[model samples]
Target: MAEFWERYAEININDRQRKVLNKLLVADPDDFEGGISNKKHISMTNASSATATRDLKTPVETRMLVQSGGGRKARYGIDWVGITS
Candidate 1:
């Protein structure tokens, strides 16, 4: 958690984005069987599909999250290497 905040300290993250990221940060591996997806983000934040996509994109752009696959198969996992805590 400290690492995450410190890493993104200079970036602007809104409430919904913060909530989703924080959840991902502390979540157990078992909690995300296939990692996080657009559907998962929507469910977690009650945000629209577009909103979820946009929110998820930021972390990926900042290298805080790593993406796998493409399109519907796409999933996101925390960039453990990037966090380095």
Candidate 2:
């Protein structure tokens, strides 16, 4: 399970996002935070925010697109919280 965190935390997440994951997912896997979504999501890297649309512009598309907005559309995958391929 430690390996899972290594992969997930590798993504550059904001302070708020970090708190969410650390509290909700990593620290207590069974603990559910108020209003925090346990849906499919990922932590984004600097590259994502730097993109034109904050989207990964590559021939090989990524699982989750960049979400620059707040709420659900504000998260992007960075293989940190990503499932190992």
Best by TM-score: 1
For model 1, residues 1-85, the per-residue Cα lDDT tens digits are: 7987887798887898888778888888799867899999999999999999999888889877789988988899887785665
Candidate 2 local lDDT, 42-62, one digit each (tens): 232223334423223320133
Highest-scoring model, lDDT = 1
Clashes of each: 0, 4
Question: Which parts of model 1 are misplaced by more than 4 Å?
Answer: 82-84
Residue pairs of candidate 1 with colliding backbone atoms: none
Using all chains and alpha carbons, the TM-scores for the candidates as numbered come to 0.90, 0.31
- Give the TM-score comparing model 1 with the true structure, all chains together: 0.90
**By summed lDDT, which 10 consecutive residues of candidate 1 come out lowest?**
76-85
